[model samples]
Target: MAAAIAARLFPGRIYVASAGVRRGSADPFAVAVMEEKGLDIRAHRPHTFEDLEDMNFDLVITLAPEAHHRALELTRYYAVDVEYWPTADPSATAGSREQILASYRNVRDGLEKRIKERLGWTPPVSA
Candidate 1:
């Protein structure tokens, strides 16, 4: 979701990728929430950090503690900035479908806000 939001917000200005410590398919709820904001994440395939072909990122943002630890270990030899952004795992929420979706939406919205703020991005004026 972060990568999708960053890609939409910055377009070709930056390269953004999302990887996890554990590999799994993109959650349907996550895809739906992103699509609500006009971002398509339906094609996103979850990959582990080991699957990254390039480790040349200028900045690595970790949304979870395990990822932060992995990022630190992986980037120790390189001069990359690693930031840990603690986020709630909406999948842990227990509720009805709509209520559960609300949790995912919260995560999506928080990520969007943080991405824009941290990247110093303002939405381009739509003409």
Candidate 2:
């Protein structure tokens, strides 16, 4: 959802990417929930921090607390802004499919709202 909002708000102005502390496949439940907001996650495959070492970014935002620790540890060697966003772990929620999907939607909506509140605005014109 963050990626989707960033994609919409910034378009070609910013490069937005997401990776996990550990490598894994993209969660289907996540894809479903994101689709509710018209964001497609079908092609988004999960990656590890190691896959992200070559590039530089202005800010590194971590959604999960565990990811916050890992990002801080990583950025200590480099210089970048690390912002921790405490978000719920939808995967940890227990219930039926609809219940689980509701959890995902809540997380997705929260992320979308936060992203908009944080960065949704007109970009400054470049000289």
CA lDDT of each candidate?
Answer: 0.91, 0.81
Residues 1-120, candidate 2, lDDT per residue (tens digit)?
577768877889788888668888879999998877787888887787778756477788889888888878777877788898888889999989999999998888888777777776
- TM accuracy, model 1: 0.95
What lDDT does model 1 reach?
0.91
Candidate 1 C-alpha lDDT tens digits along 23-115: 888789999888898888888889989999989999999999999999999999999999999999999999899998999999998998999
lDDT, candidate 1, residue 2? 89
The TM-scores of all predictions, comma-separated, are: 0.95, 0.86
Best candidate, lDDT: 1
